[model samples]
Every structure is written in structure tokens, then in C-alpha cells.
Target: MVLKYCLLLFTTLQFIQARKVVDLTHTYDKDVPKYPLGWLGLENFTYFKMDTLAAQFIDEMWIAFKKIEYYEHQGTHIDAPIHFGSGRQTLEEIPPERLIGPGVVIDIRNKVTNNSDYAVTVQDILDHEDEYERIPPNAIVSLNSGWAQKYPNANLIFGTENTSDPTTFHFPGWSVEACEMLLQERQVSVLGVDTPSTDPAQPPIYPCHIYLQTNNVPLLEYIANLDSIPPRGTTIVLGAPKVRGGTGGPTRIFALIDDDQEQEITSNSASRNFMSAIFAFMYLNVFRFC
Candidate 1:
């Protein structure tokens, strides 16, 4: 009996390890797009800088290191509630459990193609639920505007050659009403977007950021690889840094997808058969133990 239980546990662990992990974070570097400095009323600002700290040959191996400096929100990052809401949770204060949840990708690429300034509406959410299922509590809802393809190019990504001018910027974002429904009705934990801001570029007030952050919901911006994951069923894990008093910081996001779901997406029959065999073996082991 003891051996049977151990084998079952081992198999279960293997099954879990088989799940595909899609990295949803973009590579951070000096070239990544930065929020417009002009919008902050600053003429010049170094958003990201790097310097070589050490580069030498150790006793037997090469030793190299560098120092990096950048604003917390420069790259793919988390916007802690404190970013927009005074006295709210900071990066360190946010609960770890809140950083992980079921991922829901609401695709608005079609609408975005027609209008770069499109904002996700409540009806879009309703239509998503009609096709899929209701947005679950504590879910991480992300908007896929297909904006990531233009990343690293400030002009294209921001939809304006004058990247520093907020007035000329154009990008899709979440509408206040849609965010309100997710917070009030679905109780979602995180709101993510491929764009730089949670609110449309034309809206100087940033209603979505103010409203959602005040309600203690964090935001994930500049998320990459949304097109790589399924619309639903995957788990999103946000590896946010624990910076004391930080309003936001660069984050490493990952999508944990089940093997079956991955197989369905790829349509790999061999992988499907392998998963089925694993399940059959586990069932047989249970029967043998009983």
C-alpha cells in the first residue's frame, strides 16, 4: 500500500510537470519603450541606464557583472495599488496569493485594427462570457490588443511619431465601466494590458487606473505573449518584486497551461495519447492499491 501511494504521488507530480509554461513577460533592456517623459512634465529623464560593474577572469572561470538602473514601471511590470491610490497596498504589501490566479485573455485585436484608440467595453466582457464562461472570482483578466508586435518601437507601439506627446498617442485600453464590472461583479484580482497604460491614451484622467487601484486591484502592463496562451483555463503567476514602499516594479509573468489544453492548442495527437496513457496508468495503480 505504501509503495502504491508513493508511485501515485510521483506520477501526479510528473503530470503536473508536464504542463507547458509560457512566459508572458517581455525582456527588459534599454530599448524597451518608456512612458512618455513629457506627460510627466519633464523635459529629460533617463528611464533606463546600465553600467558595467565588473568584468575579469576569476581564478579559473570568467567573472562578469553589470549594474542596471531603471524606473520601477519601465518594463513589463506590476502597478501596485499604491501607484494611484494613496494608503493602498504597495509592492511588498500585496499578498502573494493575489499575484496568481486563473488567466482570462479578452482579445480585441479586430476592433483595435479598425481603431487604435479602442477601449474595451462592458459588452465585450459580456460577449466573452457568452462564448466562454463567466469571469471567475480572483481571476487575472488581460486585454490582448495585439500591441506587443510593435514593442521596442515607441512610435509604432504608441501609435504616434511624437512618442513624448501624450495628446498624439493612440492605444487600446480598458474602459472604466468594464473595469468596474470586473471588480464589482467578478471580483478579479488583477487587470492586465498589452499597452502602456490601463486607460485609453486620450483620457488624461486615467479613470481605470484611479478607480481600480483605489479598489486595491493591481495592474499588469506591457505584458507579452498573450497570443501564445489560450483564451481561458491557464493559470497566471506574476513574479512581482518585493520592493518596500514601491508603487510598482518590473515583473516576470508566466502562464501555466495544462498538458491537455496545450495539446488541444497544438493539435498533437501523440502528446494526447501519451497523456491518456498516463491517466490510465494512474487509474490502474489506484485499483491495484484498493
Candidate 2:
């Protein structure tokens, strides 16, 4: 009986651990792509720097620490509503509920293969909805342009060797119409992209940024590994820093995927129930032996 209980508990633990977590964030460092400050006349300016502050023995133990500095929006980061809007939620002010939701990825890699400035259109959203079910309310809708392959490469990612020139850069992003539909119709909680910005590299005006931010929807940019998760089933969790008054900051995003479709065991309630059943069985077995 004891062996049987141990085996059952081990099986239950394995089932609970079967869910896979896919990281959707890029590693932050000086090498990560950043907006060019040359347009603002700050040529050759470094936005990120890390230096070893301490590397010595402390209380018979070796200790080391590094001092790091970077722009709030650098690397895989969240752009809080205040990034573009005048009086919107700051980084720390964003509600925790808004940072987590179902994930939906709209792939536009084919369209973006040749045209660097391609924008995800409203029709794309409609087509995605037609294929998958209607996007759930508070979904984190992400645009997958296959741009994450060019990560840490300033020239290839931006479509220009002159990284300092914004006008010369090119990339794919979300269109205003698509963003509007997601905001107004589907009531999405967050917008995400695998590119550096939510807007195309060379837009006349940052329409998506302005409109979405004004409406108080946070944006996730420079996201990585969109190819790893499914379009609609996974749940997205954004690990954004609670920086007071910050416009934006680096974020660690993850997608939790249920590999076993038949079992449908990824839901929190179901997992709790399954664990409870295992515990109940063990308790009943112990009482019988007692």
C-alpha cells in the first residue's frame, strides 16, 4: 500500500509539471537593439552600460556585484501608457490584472519577408479570428513578423547599417487600424511585437503608440521567441518592473502551454482538484492502515 501511494503521488507530480513555459523575452544587455538617439543629435551615445562594482571576498565567501544602467525602454521592455500619452498609467501604476491574459499571435512573416515596412492590418486580425476562435477579452495580442531572428544585430534588424539614422531604418509593426480594432472590438489588454517598436521604423506619426497609449493599453516590444508558442491556447504572463513614475522598463514575458490537449489539465482549478484527489487518496490509505 505504501509503494502504491508513492507511485500515485509521483505520477500526480509528473502530470502537474507537464505544462511547458516558453520565454518570450530577449536577454537585456548593451548588445540588444535600441532606438537611435542620433536623430536627437546624441551621436555614438551608449544607452546601456555594465561595470563590475565589487569582486572580493566578504566574510570568507567570494562575492561579486555589477552596476548596470540602461534606458527604460531598452531590450525586451514594456512601454507603459505614459510613454506616449500625457497623463496615463506609469510603470508601477499599471494594474497587475492587465499584465496577464491569454496570448494570441498573428503571424505576418510572409508579408514581411520582402517588404520591411509591412504593417499588420485589420484583415489579418479578422483572418486570425476566423481560423481560431474570437480573441478572448483581455488577450495579449502579439504580432509575429519573424523579426526576432535578427536580434542583437543593429544592421539587419533595423534594415540599415547606419544604426543612428531613424529615417533609414525599416521594420514591420502593427497598423493603427488593427490596433484600433483590437482595442475597441476585442478589448485586448496588451499589444506586443517582435520588433523594436509598435510602429513601423519610419512612420510619419507614431499612430499606434499615441492611440493605444492614450487609451491606457501597455505595449510590449522587442519580444523574442514568438515561434515557440501556439496562437491562442497559451496564457501570457508579463513580468514588468514596478518602477514608480517610469515610462517603461525591461520585461520578462512567458507563455504557459498545455502540451496534452486531450487531458486539458492546465487550468488552475483542475490542477488543484487533481492534487487534492491525490492527497485524499493518501490520507484514506493512511487511515485504513492505522
TM-score of 2: 0.85
Compose the digit string of candidate 2's lDDT tens values, residues 1-290: 77687777667676665567889989988788778776567766658999999999988999999998878887899999999999999999999999999999999999997899999999998898899979999999999999999998989888898877788889999899999999999999999999988999876358999999999999999999998777878889999999999999999999888655313533346655676686678668753553
Cα lDDT of model 1 by residue, 82-161, tens digit? 99998999999999999999999999999988899999999999999999999999999999999998897989888998
Return the TM-score for each candidate structure. Answer: 0.90, 0.85
Clashes of 2: 0
CA RMSD, predictions in order? 2.9, 5.4
On lDDT, the candidate that comes out on top is 1
Candidate lDDT values, in order:
0.89, 0.87
- Regions of model 1 farther than 4 Å from truth: 1-9, 16-18, 272-290
Cα deviation in Å at residue 174, candidate 1?
A: 0.5
Clashing pairs in 1: none
| Candidate 2: RMSD to truth | 5.4
